[model samples]
Target: MSSVELREGLVVVAKGIVCVVTKFTSLDNISVISQKEGKRFIVPFDEIEFFPAVTDEGVALIAPELDELARNASDDEITLAESRFDVIGRYSCGEISLAEALVTLEMSRSNFYRLKKNYSEEIGMLSLLRYNRGNSKGALKLTDVVERYIQESIDEVYSGSSASISKVWSDVEAKCISSGNPLPSMTAVRKRIKMRDEKELYKKKHGADAASQKHDARPGKKIFSRPLERVQMDHTLVDVILVDNVRRQPLGRPWLTVIIDQYTRVILGYYLSLHSPSAVSVSSAIYHAALPKFSFLQKLGVDVERYPYYGVPEIIHMDNAKEFRSKKFESACIRNKIKPEWRPIGKKHYGGHVERLIGTFMTGKVHFLPGTTFSNVVKRRGHNSDKASALTFKEFTKWFVKEVCIYHGRKHSELGCSPGSKWAEYFGAGGDAPMHPPIVSNPFKFKLDFMPEVTRSVSPQGIEFKKCFYWDAALRLHVGKAAVMIKYDPFSLGTIWAYLDGEYLPVHFSDVTKSDFSLEEYHAQKMQGRGEGHTPAGGLEDRSLAEYVHENKELVKRSQSETRRARKAEAARSEYLSSQREESNEIDVPVDKTDKADRPNYSRRATPFKGKNYD
Candidate 1:
């Protein structure tokens, strides 16, 4: 090898980014970056734009077409990757960052940077052109849509923002409108809006449904039956984070759900989430609670299979919510072999046990950050934020063991004595060693994703959904194909890949695939069509229930169902009106026969406790 001493001169431009090529013994790759605290990127020789000019010291590099890269490269693609690499390199190689190297090489960071970036990324340049061209034609609306899509990609970066998707969309529209821009077509605008709305709806619906699923997962419907017989769980939303150091403003309350022994209230499991009260986090808390308490479980008369809840609760209680009634929830209960017992709607007494515990958090030591609503109060109380920084979810769990099993171990202040002593005294939980061992998470392992049978049908072209068929062009080869299994990534809400006959295709839905945009609306229209005729198309001859029953049993049954449905519809309308009335007394509430039927139920629940009888 020739005698060539390598000096870090003006880091030369390679590809479109700034890079430095060391002329020392055969170097294979070069890392380039920007100096800004949060803005940096790296590109190998192939990716970076390099200048033909080479200084005596080494090759000089500049971030050519920096604007294009800034526009097209994702924050993670550039900023995060660069920062992470630099940090890692500092630890491992102690290599100076690209910006620093540039400073030392060319004596001017910006000047050397300009030289390296002689070439622009054509792809990024094209994207810029695409965005700018839309300016004359509802471009801002399109920009708003793109922004939303991009925002989701980096949502974690702005997780603190309270701006909802709808709010953001509205803000975009207003800003454009204020500038006298013509709005995008309403249909197109709605197409843009529905994407996020669908996920939100799905998330809410699933969360509600998951609660019952948790019940189904209980080792027993009632934990007291014969040791680990059942577990009862409920989530509480609380206000916390008195001072959000990140935002320098108050944060919304956190939600925490605990899965406890329906029999022991032993605090078997719990989870705290930044989101509001939800089933997903509730399940997580329960999962964390369940997996670890196993060794202690055998002591309580439980095993692995026997662990999932069995024998339904004798009297389970919760405020009426969709989570309690969802089909999935019911199925979970059925699967776990437990009968679900739901508290009467709005009945506070029925839920008093769980409610009172939650209440303690509200008035007890749990601190409520300002702006905390009643919902927030409950969350802050259950969150176990005192140990929020625990390295692992399981470690944070130690806080519950300390709080519920330790500090509160005394003569049930609430239990009348300490839970441990109370357990020995009342439930007869004495002398039995915990069944399995205290459950611990396998830090080396992660949860296997839940795999559910997604009801689907396949044909020549692709899969069919809601009476519509969708198959990407690449899949056309497999048209009239057999059933294909698709796994979805929850975080991205996108298809991870598809499997056809056990072969992974890595295929995702493409633009050509028509989405179920009007699924809910179409179903509503179908239901409306079914509701058109009751007595008769033109005559009242069948109006009498007896006549209808005699002529057509089906008609009679349908009429009865229609009657019930009509009553429900009327009640819902009345309830909505009543809510509006509360907001503004001048608004007249709707009159409904169902309201009369419902008022009694509400009044009964709200009735000052007359002792606790459903009847």
Candidate 2:
């Protein structure tokens, strides 16, 4: 009847009922079995309406125009789809166990099975792309009145009490009846309670410390056989206190975020700052890990010949810090083919490699610094870290790099060779035939992809960040538009990249003559209430921010501690920007002073919410 081909195992509708095509008895007739009943029958091909297949397991199915639709999807959507496809691909290749796949994908057993089946049967990437935007089947379907009633009852009845589920459900039902709302079943009440976080539930029922004790466990270590296969990331406050760059006064201890290759025990990358660890620190470390480090070392003036460690890791193991759990970091990892694996709640041993490496560094080398605080209070009691502070932030950074080089060359007890030797054994010209993992081709674009992003409206005047306006001739057409996604280098405040249409257009300070300044310096000046040069047009006055900082000697002397800390942070920012500039020739991202011609003519992957209004 229809020109569409009919073959065995193909799903189609026959006589208003869903069925699987068994065979074409002849050109004029086809045999089919009812999907629900398994009853076989032959029907005339002409009599069949040739129903278009549209549903799968009660979910609406999309047509197979996948390629065009996929290309049209936002960058985030495409990245997420590819990530799901990668999980399924790994499972199919037998590279990861099904259990590991389930954990990595963060999918339930049944959900993962359905995804695998759909991926295997149809367009893999398309199937992984979620077309449904509503709640899945079996989700709680209670009205607001019932939900509120249950919540109130739970707060009044079960919280801080050893009440059983049945008791709580009975109380919730009674409350629902009294509230004049439809009563939910015991199963629904249990499911609602189960939907809550286990830690929250435990804390509400028992206590906060009890919940922590329950979740904290020391599990065995995980071993990997290849470099970059399972990298571990963690952050710690440096044991030693440091001084400022200019004044060399005692500053507070800085935070350090480190990433290490578990297989080779080699340090991949690190970020240091006076501020505590945040999403920015984690992102910078990841960006650093994926970039070629030869230029970075040369710029630092470190004498190390090779630190050949850079790639999109297969799995990044991390603790349950909020920074590691940020949607931005997770999205970046998935986009780059990295599987983020959190250490099981309470399983400290899972991150042993990086932990031990940090410990060795701090105890073995850092404790010898002039302002060392040592490891514990007992050891640090007489140190007076602030009074004994000696090294400036720059000096400390150079010394840290030298220590890292030294650490890489020493023999490891477990491997019976140095980390550098192990790295070369696997990736060098000989050894076990080198394994070349994916290298980050465009380091600058890679950094932008992982950098912090914020949404702001484009005013006729320009885009404002930290009370500073950035504008460009190209942004004039985009004025009056809202939710222009922007990415900025924290180290440099004079320029920012605005996502317009599809590409990141670099916008500079409205006053192009002003010198670039670090965010830390700006905040420090603002906090001191010294550099408030306001113009009549609700803008900053035309003055050199650098000059203002230089003239504020009294303020710096009055707030020595805070100024020293700020200077240390600014120094870190300066070094970071320096490394970035050194590697700019390897990528297409334009530097400050946008000439349009020098800018990279590339479009970022579109995000799914491209059309949504930020207002």
Candidate 3:
């Protein structure tokens, strides 16, 4: 047999069968174990064909079949070739004589002694597979001239230069000849470059952002142990144009804020509005999520048999949007005992649940509606969305409610059941459902508790806020006193709650006639008048009661039209409040009746009294 170079543990094809080399025998024969048959055979080294080098794609193409065989192979069969070391170890410990062990194992004495000599030299399995195992080699073959040339070429490539491999090779050859050194082959240079990791190469060619997005490790899907363990909330602009209720003219697109339960993949609550997202939108969605939704469905005319979801989640996952990270949002979460978890910056996929929900709703349902934008500019080509708009804001809201109900009943891809059904399974059906956290007893009080707060002094003209005066019978006793903390809802300037004594007292606009407008609408109207150079003059505190009366006279006609709308809204509010009271068994307490004549006042004031400056 020809003297072929071979080593132990080197994988090769022997007689057309895939096998790994085991050992060398005294007669210069080689032992190899077949991967598929798990059998050992001794043959000449010339019978083995070493594995050929292939590209990554070629390796992947044949990986499955090889992987299956490797997975199914028994552990003992795979490690059986290493057993000879165990025998050698035992004999060295005086367990048996070398001759006796060799005889029992049916091996020649020369082969046994050679194996012992290789083991004693501390050669590892991989070292044994190498061609020149343990041979002393000279220092690295690359001359200093070639090393400097290669380094400079790599630095140039990494500096955003568009130098090709051939160009680098040409430059390196030129530098080598000038220094009187033998020119290196292009193949050697290419091999060195391929050793660098993909991330580093991408960073050199593109940028850090591209490299991070391509190579950063991401977390896998999280499994929540129970319902309401974590909830994700986000906002997206709906992909459909809306029309005005009265004029039937196309308004701009509206925004939708959705909150989803991570465990059940159910939509806990959502809010839709023509205005952009803000702290108010987030608060509205969270408040609705914490309360039972049967009343809301009835108001929307949805005839769903049951809506089971309602909870104060343990944790709320959110992106780093300004509205979500604001102090008001943080304070609300802290007060409700809910943990706020902000996803890492630049990693929006952490809140993938809500993001996916938005995409699905917009692409699947909204795209089919009139005046749909079709999600992207490419899909929306040649479509006149604004002109095609036919549904008014009110109509769109009703349609949206119906769609949500349908979605609740539809089966989810991963959950294998409807969101509503899953919710029922987690918390039982009908009367046996697991007890959830109780809904807020008073809806008005609940809104006040979560609203943003501001401090205002009680002047003789009543509590002044945003250039408007709010007063109640309770404010008479607080006038000329220190400043008191008051909380107001941005959505409704109709009423505010002042923290006085030890309780929150409901305060209404002194001129009940102007109480129908929202803070947003009030500002909008003022801005409209200011555009025509009719801005209100004088400081808020400097205006006289007569001037205020005159201003009220000028707005009387607009207020009359507002009054009719307010009445309709008031009826709806009454119905909602009645439902909340019945469900929670709570009663509204009168502010005046909450006081006791014999009780001593222990409430802290903003400023100390003249006779008693209590700290």
Candidate 4:
């Protein structure tokens, strides 16, 4: 029972299960303590342990087992196990977790896990464990040799070919012999080491090594000019298995749509929904981004709107999913003066920002949460099958627009700051960074346009558009002669609504009779399997729209030549009429007022969030 501490100028020498050294009170008080005792002694740091008085009620955590562990451990064994005790106590006391210590020590987790579960040596700690290197762990034991060999073999198998196992084992053996260390047989090695540990080690080492090589880490490029010129769009699946509380049933898998400014890494717009990343979803995402709620940031002195990219993306980079390239999607981007930048087929690294975001959200955070979650409303709906357990299309949309996105805008985990802050920093508003001057004007204009149109049908029951329908007695009046506008989803004919003049007629498309097929449907039914049909997820392989159009220019030009001639004739007629009217006005005569009278203004509506919400 040696109660001792190391004295100045005296090193503890550890022999086979024994030690010899002078123990004293302190570095400066060493002479006094030794003079009083009048004897030299040896004990490891582990043998020198203490607990505050039981009656003292000190703030230091009272580990009931600690005092017993100290009292039980012999003097000689403490020297060798000093490192072990220190790590355990510091870990048990929560001064620092075992993980932090292990990472600091750069040791394998398996060793520490075993030590944590089984070892009970009392070594004085963080102060010592940090300074003392565990170099004298001694020559490899039989199990240690076997484990090392197995890990090396597994590493070999993963690094290259599995059939090279024999060569790998021979290589390790030759190295061990060269280094004068005992080596294990291939069979002993393979049987002793667990495959899971090998796989984990291999993954950790290889992953870190690969990432180090991959992250060349050049400074990121500064974004300049047209707002959405480069939007990094990605599809992330959130998996909380959201369920309708009332029905206790599944909702659906929620898809997260993020429109990030590639140059700035600003999240221009974002949305979450039980729907796929459709055109509507993309539009909704951009719309919210185009009009973000920045009042909080404004109060924080961030003027986001004045920032370079307050709204509108010029180029949206997306994967080659069908949803990204469908006519509806292309039309939206074209109408909004945005070019859809498609990643090369199957090449993801180029679009890593948004792609990685998906992994970060689903597997990393959402699903990794400790308990159950109703995160994937869409997938849940498929599982639950209860309508009530589902989110109304409108409600899901608002939540995404208002909450999910707002949260992303403020959360700083991913982007250096909240995504919205990046906008200000990049644009030279809030940040002290120098701004890249803006381009005078975007060379690209809207290559396409959207004509607000609808799908309609006059029926005894009702008409539908995009899976919804409408029916009203007023619609009956317009059934034959009136222009009954079917407020429809040009994307899906299943839903529709009847509109007459500028008024919505009462009727939901879902309420329409579902008995018969329309003429388009009849044709589609007859022509089943004749073609690939409307579309699929895959895009038209490896080519951009401009390239596609360029390749077909001759044929398309010839086809549109007739339409071009008609348009030219109308322009010439209008020019002639204008010239005559101008001449008559010069002669002081009143000109015909037909032009003004013929095109009377109809009902008009104000655009919501007009212009852009920049800051």
Q: What TM-scores do the predictions have?
A: 0.30, 0.48, 0.53, 0.37
Worst 10 residues of 2 by lDDT: 525-534
Model 3 Cα shift for residue 588 (angstroms) = 99
For candidate 1, the TM-score is 0.30
Give per-residue lDDT, candidate 4, residue 558.
81
Pairs in clash, predicted candidate 2:
74-606, 75-606, 217-346
Q: Which candidate is the best by lDDT?
A: 2
Better of 1 and 4 by TM-score: 4
Clashes of 4: 55
Runs with alpha carbons beyond 4 Å of true place in candidate 2:
1-221, 435-437, 457-462, 466-469, 480-482, 491-495, 509-615
Tens digit of per-residue lDDT, candidate 4, span 75-168: 4334435656666677778898767879754678887776565543322321121222353223334655545655665556535323344555
lDDT by residue (tens digit), candidate 3, 1-615: 223246666666788665778888857678888875778998786776654323445432223333243434454544443456566777889999978789765789887777666553222221112122452233346777787787677666544536466766777777788888888788767755666687887777776656777888876777886788999999999999876544556666878889999988888887776678987778878877877777567756876465557788889998888989998778778877789999887776788789888999998999999999888899999999989988866578789877887888999997899888888776754575665545667766556656767899999888988778998988889888776998886556778889999998889889977845445445444443444333366725444667877888979978998998999999999999999889765666556654586666678456655795568
Candidate 1 residue spans exceeding 4 A from truth: 1-231, 242-249, 293-317, 368-408, 423-615
Off by over 4 Å in 3: 1-220, 303-308, 429-446, 454-471, 477-485, 489-494, 509-615
lDDT of 1 by residue, 539-579 (tens): 55455666655679877888999999999999999999999
Each model's lDDT: 0.44, 0.76, 0.73, 0.51
Arranged by TM-score, best first: 3, 2, 4, 1
For all predictions, the C-alpha RMSD in Å is 35.5, 36.0, 29.0, 31.9
**Tens digits of per-residue lDDT for model 2, 1-615:** 224556676555578544567888887889987654568998887665432333444333446544335434555665677688888898899999999998898989999888777683334455676664576445768898888877776666666758567777888777777777787888888887787788878878887656776775545556677788889999999988776655566666777899999888888888876677888788878877877677568757965475667777889999999999998789888887889999877666677789899999999999998999999999988668889988865577678878888888999999999998888887765656766556677777888978878999999999998798898999889889998898986556778999998999999999878887655445443432432332455454656675776669767777998888999999999999999888986888755786888877678664576676779
Q: Report how far residue 69 has shifted in candidate 3, in Å.
A: 26
